[model samples]
Target: MSGTGDDFKWFGEGFDGFPKRLPEDVVEYIIFIINSKLSAIQTRERLQGFQRALATLEKKFLKEYIWQRESIRMDLVCDNRRWFLRGTTNYGDSVADEWLIVYFLRELSQEFPDAWIRIYDTDGEFLLIEAANAIPSWLTPEVAENRVWINNHHLCVIPVSDHDNPKSLAIEEALSIINDVPTKLQHLPKIEQEAFYRLKSFPSAISENQHHATLPIPRKLAYILRSNPSYIAPAVEAFYLRDPISLRLLQPEKSRTQLNFPPESFVSVSVRFTKVLYAQLLGQQWVPPGPYGEALAKLISKESGVPSVSREKAEIGIKVTAGFEMLAQHKLYADKKATREIQLLLEDIEAGDEALPSDDEIARWPKREDNEGWLDIDFVEFEKELAGKGAGSTTRGFGDKNAQDNLRKMVERFNKFIEDEDAGLDGAKGLGLDPMDIDNDSEAPPVGWEDPEDSDDSDDNEDDDEQADKEFEEYERTFEKFLTLSSAEKSALLDDARELAQVEEAEKEEDEEIKKLSEMMEAELFSHGALNLGAKKNSGVKPVMGDGEGRGKAKLEEFLEEVDDNDVEYLDEDYNLAENMLQAFKGQAGMAGPAGNLMSMMGICFPPDADTDEEFKNKNKDPVNNK
Candidate 1:
């Protein structure tokens, strides 16, 4: 039965050394060992077994043995009771220490069936119950006959003479001695009162709705006062509670350590003090506190401004009057200012006034002029001209029908001259003249020449006849030489000669007017600078006089520059010209110049005027005009 301090060690060690300084892992391991060693039934059996063993050991052990074992047993029982006590404390039960109170209450309930009793004790000794009446009629008969002997154990009942007006003197005495009464209830002294008025008043005193009306002081302060009534009662009796006015006027200086101010009246004081502190610290009007603090303070102040039930209480009578006034002022200003702005806006809308047109709208509109002070050319006309000539049709020509007919006739005559030269050379071969002889005899008539015979022309005839005879004799000799060849050889030679003649004819014809027409076109384009000669020959039919005029170019440049310098309407005459010019050069080879210039004009024209054409022109003009 004897044991050393180690026997008591396991009590403090906890189920797994949970309350002692053991490592968590060791504690867990011990818990596992304990659980493995005991099932639910075995755990209950072990408890009963230990209790029985303690009773037996207490009787049989030596004095020292009894002391050590008793210490261990006491520690074990205390630890177990503590575990159960925690489990029951929420329902106001003390499993180990307060069982007697519960037992007494149950017994009294049975003895006095029509009434209930509440017992209060300070040190777990003498018990006192406040009863509505004496013992029940059933119990009074047994007590009068002395058959119940209730005083045998710790049951001592001192009966009241007047059961209808039972006193709480014993209950109060018991309550006064209980050391563990909550601090809020410790100072109430024992008093002799038959009706228990204080207990009856407890419920109403604590009800939040009734606290202000029935309590002499603020609920929070009264609560403090009641708990320490000994200290507060004297002050209440002496009428020494601090003046509310003095507290209201008191303003605590700002302290960095304290952030919260009393919410009701103190908000303004805090705000004003905060402003002063801010001005002092940062040399400026008040800025809000840190983000979180400002948010919380704002919420609290906003709530304080609204009336609540607590506000009706004298103790919490402080109101945010100034804060509300300031808020009202701000709201009034905001509303008035907003109303004025709305009125102004409505007026503007009614008057049909608007800000300037957006840039995108202006961009989408047509253009006018460029920077060079030239009129924008109508590219549509140029495109029409180009389209007409590009098809290579004579209908697109510049001159009237008569002029075109004359030109056509000249081309035909030139072609006929080439055809005649070819025919002459072909006939020379048929006349028995060597085509080579014909080529060499450029001054001679072709081989078919013969003079008409006249009867009186013998003298002139002699000269003519002599020339003819001589030419014929020479031609016959050349023919005989040509005829001396084999038929096949002559035929072959003749074929070769004919081909040479035809080639020569073609060369002569090509040398005639096609070359002339080409040169003329080149000259025209070169002279007027209407078109560049270096332009591809396939460049569509030449620009005529009107189409190629320099006047259009001058006008275009002038219009573009003016449009560029001024804010002219998009559909203005100049803008149409620029737009047409832009369209003209979209796909054609010659359009690049006009297209680029037109786009440049469009960019400069639509925006607000940065510089004007007159200014630019005057700057470039003669000094007399500049003056």
Candidate 2:
């Protein structure tokens, strides 16, 4: 009887006057019965009544009913064409709910083909029979873990702890359930299956009569719909189709921990300014050249103002264009001046002079001339004489024809004298005088004269020679007196005369050798194909003459003058001893020591050591231990 009453209430009066509008009270009471009942027929009949009421209100609230009507129309289109629903109960036969599900599926499939849907029975088991043609049980398990429904199809069931309210299952949540299914089932009619599952699983109609009894929309989804009202539920469902969990998780968190510190705008400004300054400096726009360049140029100009193009540009134009070059030149000049002053100061200190310029003062002073005026008058006169003569005449010319004639005569005379000496030596040899014996003679031979007719002049020359013979005899007697003495005495007398002769001969020979060598070297050096080895005239220094036997004596005299008193005394003592020994050799015949020995002792006494000390200290002290 209870079963009959339940069936009668479900099939007989539930969907009575189905296509027409139900009374508001009847619709509300029907929604209440649908919510309380577990039977599919009762739920279906109540949903049919809600649909009729929605249609009746459609014309009156056309704009509001457009989305609802369109949803119903899409569901009907899908359900009516199915074979299983050909002759079902009136609400079961209605295809509006199915068509609405198909519409949502089409929208979800466009965005994400991998999306799917699931349906659950009132007991939360796979509702295979109820959704047999629309969605299979196999698609439901894919999202069984993150499902919207739990133990039962009742609206009281919720999957996640946080989403316990059935009101949370809004259009977005329904779309999410479809998207969360396995990717393999996404190509199925996901949106249609999702809508079908939502109706079968929840089994409640959304109508004005049951408006108060309907589950509340999820706060997140409701906010989204309110914010983006232009987008319909199917459009929002499309977003979830691609990524269900992530899209749902995008809901704003209530307890967000965002940072609140103000951004530092000055950092970028400071960096930009620093970069600009660095670029300017690197580009050489800001930094100028130092003072050394100009200082050096000024010094050069002051010291030697030879007007030159480069110098003018360095001094004037360079200052205008690249001024630092001039500054660098100035610094260089200052450094040079400072260096020279330091050297001069050292020299002064060595000389015991107290007054000397400081380095700073020297650096500040103007450039001075390096060369001192030391003119060679003879050279100047010679140059003047050369200038006076015409270029051609100055060359090695036959000086005034008469002078050439006189030179030729002089050459002939010199040649005749040489010939006469040869003849005299041959005659002496023929007269039994040994040629070697001639070299033994203390005096050199007198100059011989040439006569054209020696036979005719012999008698006249004999008469003149007779008087000369008497004077010569007397001179021979005097000379023979010194020769008769012991060899020691004779050598002593000869040495006195030789010393006097040597002095005069040395002076003459030194002068002649210097002049000859200078002329020879000058000619060789200046000649083509030879090295131009000559002192630079600009240096204003004379060329040093080569040391010769007699020429070296002057250098010795200078050295002797420069020697300290102690060295002079030592030399004088040794030389006096040598003189005494020489005198003793004269007194005692053939008793002289080696002359070389005396010379060696003199050399030791007159050592080349120069006394550097202010006092006449022992300059010749042994280096190992100077006592």
Candidate 3:
């Protein structure tokens, strides 16, 4: 008020007219700014934005809000409409003023019963949540649902009123499709995009097939197969995946739903990467931090874009990436080769030494069978079980007339997958030990097993031509199929090559992510387990980590079991114990010289370490120390 500038003139009008024109809302907003100590210009900026929102609100409040869409019921004002909502991005902070406007309109909706607030992110992302006096669902089936989500060209409507009701098969199938859309999109790189599109087009295509192409169903499928013959059973499997009993396709949408304070505001998160920031203060662990923070710290440090992003943008990115732990069951990956993968996965799930698979996580993956032990699996059934839900083998469409074309397409796709994975190239490069390099150079010093610079058989001129021929032939044969492909095919193959380097790159990234998740679980487990173990482990004294006690004893037992299983073989009752002992003795000495040397060979019966009674005094004794 003291300033003489024209800007000061408007400051008075803002204070005066906003209260009169919007008495209820202006007072609160003005007080909010004053309490927060906003500057004169800052107050003016916010007021202007508020006025503009009002201007937009004036156009359609009473008309649209009179009777709710899809209903003849008279609309009534909901008592509370104020909401402060955000996505799980940047620790749940709203990125732009549009969100604030959304918040403002939500409040305004309460003040005016005849207002229908429609708000969506202009960015074409984030959740589109609609709030009104009432939403239509279940009990109010004639009316629209509480939420209509249009995300990434996908529609998923959540009818809150149907909370306790069971949906019909059609709706559930549609729901499943939307629910899994994100994973399908993520795995698109593994399969051709066309195959996915064809699967998704089924609902419409199947109906069409009934009307237009019913008679030539097999022939039409065959014709479509001519171009993409490799699609095979997987495609048919995906097509029939709408089995009502098991699977359906759904769009994948990341969501957050909450009842805000004041109980009037409607809140929803409709997308995975919505810009709701999570406010993580300095020094506190990020809302969901890994238990072992080393990996997370490295990830944060290695974020090449972190330095380049502004503080505000970095906050959003942090929140966005935080939601990446989508559901992927490791058990679904169980196979004969699963031992290595599972062991590697469990390596991260460790807190010092104990395996940390959650009870629920391992419940049905058929581990040691849980003291219902001595497991024997019918591998035929085990393979089916291992495929898990929504596996490629979900359906047996291979028998359909489309099998031949599908097989070819699958073969081509698999070959391409291997090429894309560079599984073929690595084998080719394994021939780096080129004998030609040594053979072509006559006077070069020979490479020796013990010493590199040792004169390479300089005195002997025996060049093992046999080994060289074998190496060259093997190398050629390795690449023979790919090499013999036509030029066009080769060009296609090269185009698909992309780079094998990415496999290692992705694997390293996956390992880091796994480590990050493990760390979070690790810290949690340590707090729950280790903290409680100190008293039991120490016996009111220092921990004895090396003796048979808490952690050490457990670890020792596990190691011995692993060693025995790996290094020893067992026989059935058919062989007598004496015979087995004799057989082992025979492998050791083979009765090679005869009984004439038996006395001198007493060295075999009396091994060098035989007299040492102390060697195994503590052998297999439980380790009694805290580890």
> Of the candidates shown, which would achieve the greatest lDDT relative to the real structure?
2
Better of 2 and 3 by lDDT: 2
TM-score of 1: 0.15
Model 2 RMSD in Å is 60.7
User: Residue 592 deviation, candidate 3, in Å?
Assistant: 34
Encode model 2's per-residue lDDT on 1-627: one tens digit a residue: 001221123355575422222222110010112132235464455444434544544444333221311232212112322111101111121233333333332333333222222322222223322233334333343233223321111211223333342222332454344335322123334333433343432212222111100111222222222232222222212221323332222222421322111110100000001111112222231211233243334434643232232332233222222211111122232343322443344455458674333335433533322111111123323333334332233343333222233343344444544555434744422233445756666687887886766777888888889989999999988866754577579658877998999999999999999899777644533342123223232332111111332344466456557778778566554344433333332333433233323334555222222222222246545678875
Tell me how far candidate 1 lies from the true structure as C-alpha RMSD in angstroms.
Answer: 56.8
Q: What would the per-residue lDDT of candidate 1 be over residues 130-226, giving only the tens digit for each residue?
A: 2212233222211211111111112323333345343223323322322233122211112112113223322222211110111112222222222
Quote each prediction's TM-score. Answer: 0.15, 0.12, 0.14
Per-residue lDDT for 73 in model 3?
13
Clashes of each: 18, 37, 41
Candidate 3, 246-317: lDDT as tens digits: 111111121232101111111111111111111221112233233113323433454332222233333323
Q: Which runs in model 3 stand beyond 4 Å of their true positions?
A: 1-466, 477-627
Top-down lDDT ranking: 2, 1, 3
